[model samples]
Target: MSLLSKADEAKLKGQLQDAVISCTERCLYSSAKWAAELLNSFPETDDDGSETDVDSAMSDPPPPQTPTPSSKDPIEARLEARETQKYLLAKTFFDCREFDRCAAIFLPDSLPKTSFLVTPSPASKSKPHGKSKIKLGTPTKPALSAAVVKGLSQKALFLSLYAKYIAGERRMNEDSEMILGPQDGITTNKELPGISAILEEWFSGLANSGRKPQGWLEYLYGLVLAKGKNEKQALEYFIQSVNCCPYNWGAWQELSTLFSTIEELHQVTPQLPQNIMGFVFQIYASQELYQSANQVHNSLAQILDIFPGSAFLQTQRALLYYHSKAYEDAEQIFSELLVANPHRIDAMDCYSNVLYVLENRPKLAFLAQLAMTTDKFRPETCCVVGNYYSSKSEHEKAVIYFRRALTLDRTFLSAWTLMGHEFIEMKNTHAAIESYRRAVDVNRKDYRAWYGLGQAYEVLEMHSYAIFYYQRAAALRPYDPKMWHALGACFGKVGKVANGIRAYKRALVAGSFYDNNVGSSFGSGEVSGLGGGVLDPEVLFNIALLYERVNNMGECAAYMELVLAQEEGPDYDESVGDMAGGVGVTPTTSKARLWLAKWEYMRGMYQRSMELANELCQDGVEVEDAKALIRDIRARIESQKGDSSVA
Candidate 1:
């Protein structure tokens, strides 16, 4: 026997038959008018038929078949047929919106009778041949209207198909096939033709209907299209929405975002809403879209009819100018901001920087002081104040501020470095070294910290440590001539003469002139060993001394000659005047002239040497040793010439 009982199987068969009959009748009725319309619209050709042929085709007769009820009651078959006809009529009337007629069809008098039966197959001997079964009472109709029933059934079928599609049943083949298939002999295009036109028509209808879309639906729909599948359609929708609601910030915001995504913000920046101008400005600023940002700023300024008084905006504009190296313009704006808002820490900080750029240390100090009054706890402000004092050579005060800055923020490397410099100026070598080491620890890349450490070590006679720091500084700032010069000096202090020479050459190439760091460069100071300071005379003399120490005697003599030629006064008179003032004293001009004479005589230039000696003797100011040496030289010249003008 089958898994289902015979009675159950019969009941299920009866329901299935009823459903099939109902569906067929509805399909036939709906198709009738649609088919007629298709036939009327069908084209006539020689190969096909004329209008009369089409009309005849529509009116063609169907051959009748004799109704048969096999093994079932005749009343049951007739009732089922009548029920199917009622179902179809109700569906048609409901589709045409004839609700009353549709409701009457599914009333209590119209339902079909249901029956149960048991039957045995020809191959199954265990079951009886057949047993007819029928309900004794008439069937009761559903209270709901036939229109509602038809709609519910259609809705259920559509839902089932949608669920299957979502579940990936048949791989989307079912939906695609049915949607593309012909309906009522009318062929449907596979791909949507004129979809754009359809959408335009829908939009036009919406506009003409004057129905306001609720909430942000209209905006959201436009936004989806704008960012989703069709940007042009989305734009049209957005424009319509904007026309409907001019103050809609959402539409404007979405439209602005769309412009940014496509990098066409320049075109849309002017169209942004005034209320959300800040957000638009932020986006442009983040992207570093300066030209567009400026344009937007101008437009916003006009719209608001007021300049932004926010210190932040002023600082931002100032920073842009600073980055472009427009120091004057940056200074003007920064100063204005500081004046307007005295408590703006950033403005004060930037003002200090601008003053530094202008080389106005006094102004920098003033701004730094102003900043400190507002925020005395700020380490950067304290450091700036310390820098100002340090530049003025007020090491004690500089140290106080620097130490205070470091106390507030121990990681402030600039303050640490400034403190180290103060110690160096005060000749506290060990303290300077400690401070510089702390700076290096705070910021390993601080080249000035390493250089200060080197100088402090050199002052303490720790040549090796000095050399190490100098090397590190050189590595950090290889292009700095001062670093090269410092390295050379460190090498020289450590007795590395050859290395020192090489370093000096590097310093020369790096643009460190001999007089750059010397005392004479600032005047009123004594330069030991070289005998002159920063003056041209001192530099030439130092060059001569260095050459002589290196055993370049000819070079030493040549530089000495250059010095003598450039001297403003007579050599002997200048020597006398220097002696009276206790400055640049030479033992005797006669002796120096005699040495020069002997040097020229040895080089076979006797006439030149004799003339130099004569000029020296003619000055009438000679020492006893110089006079005796001159007498002996005159007797020797008389003997060589055999003149016999005996002395």
Candidate 2:
């Protein structure tokens, strides 16, 4: 397509380089003291030193040889100016939403490989390495110098690629919710438009040139591969990226997304540079998986000694508490964060969640209004608004706001999960499942979405499917009692008694360890309609019920006794169990007493049954059943006495 052939283009680029070098050398020649510095920078020559004359020397009169104002290298100064100009122009185009123009300024997709960005230098072909020779041809490296190239690579590369990616997403502003994310989910990234083809060809060109990608390019490549769902290759490139430039949080974020399980994370974590940034990545990963609460707590504690003022580290701490169901602790941190940095909106969505859970509607509404006033269109602000509506039971409006957040950024994982929650509240199980699936698609490490899908499936009575989903969530948050508890319930519903018992036991151990190591996540006898079950009296009662299901009366009675004993204290009365905030057995007390009484009666312990039934009767719980039980016991005793007298 070019008028010149490859040979002519190479010769032209060489001539241009010579002019730039000659102009640079002539400027130094004006300062005789600097003339010697230009010798090493000149082009290679023949052995006899009879070489091509400098292009400007062949002219009759020389152009002005004045040194630059700063006494800087004229060529280098020009490159700096050009770099800045191009970057500012590209940034302006991006701000104006001219995404294609913004990207083309750096990485033009419409043209052939014959652009100003890349020029093959004949001198660089077939470089020697020991006795071997490595041929590097047609490199993707730009003609810019090391310093100029580094400056441009920092901002232009990421921004330009990000622009291209957004364009390739093929989004239309008017697209409906159903169109943005279908029933299957937003798995359309692999179907990116022509930009993807162009990028692929360019990447191939880099590979063919025998030059590995730069750190930033590797990061971009990983992002593209991740978007296309080539996770394994994406992971390798991400690792390479961090090795090349370990301080880039952007690369770490993309790298962390590929890990769906803690095992995968653990395996890859050692390979990552264990610098300060890598430690931050570990904390971030812990928050995402919700598994290593202890690591999040202790590791963040140590790191905060170095960066105590970092709001991000503080939010990770709050999130750790949130995942552990320690809402009060989490709320305190969030409140402190907002007070210290009033303009911060990074974790407002999480703060809103804590408020919503605590049912502090006034604070929630205030937060919503504050965020809306600050930046109403941010995904976090939209989520806060959505939570506000959700707290008010405005399910439809909440969903609309959540959808708006997703429309702005579909990769906003919280929006997808929260929208699914709204759908679940509206009792639209199918829609909820779709939303949750989309969340998982965006980041499989988001255990909340997996758990939400499980809950939705559970609501639909699809116990088998619910178990599968719950297991996925539990794997991410292995220490989370709620996830294990959900899995146990699903197993029970599916008639997998042994698996149910094992899952319930995991819930019990997880809860105990959590309380011991991470503080009491859920306080004693506390029941949250929104929370997953823990190793409280409720779990004990479930274990008892399951044991009774399998006809294991001994274990059933043992667990029932444990359930009631937790409520028993020196100040507690038998009648205090059902009282709110009581030291007694609490809301599940009556159920446990009824089961224990029935078990006693079955085991011929009629007197124990009578005492328990009498307590239930006095407590005004199971009154009718208690009366019938008392009558039957009394009648049986009279009949037994008659038989004894007859004998």
Alpha-carbon RMSD, each predicted model: 34.1, 17.0
TM-score computed on alpha carbons, candidate 2: 0.73
**Per-model TM against the reference:** 0.36, 0.73
Model 1, runs deviating above 4 Å: 1-361, 388-394, 512-544, 557-647
Model 2 regions more than 4 Å off: 1-88, 106-160, 170-213, 291-295, 513-535, 569-587
True lDDT of residue 101, candidate 1? 52
Clashing pairs in 2: none
Per-residue CA lDDT of candidate 1, range 1-647, in tens? 11344455344334333323332333323223322322232223343344446466654633212222211334334434546555566657655645435545543223333334444356555543343323443223233433433333221222222222222322223333431133211222211122222233334554554333322334545644543346666665665554443334345445543432324554544444333333435443432322223554454334222223444445656665543335677788887876776675643544554565566777787787787787888877887787677667788998888777765655566677767877877888887887888777645556678888888888888889889998887675554446666776677666675676566556545442222322210112222222122123333444554565677878766765545443332233464443321223232333445555665665756566667666656655444444555555676676767865542
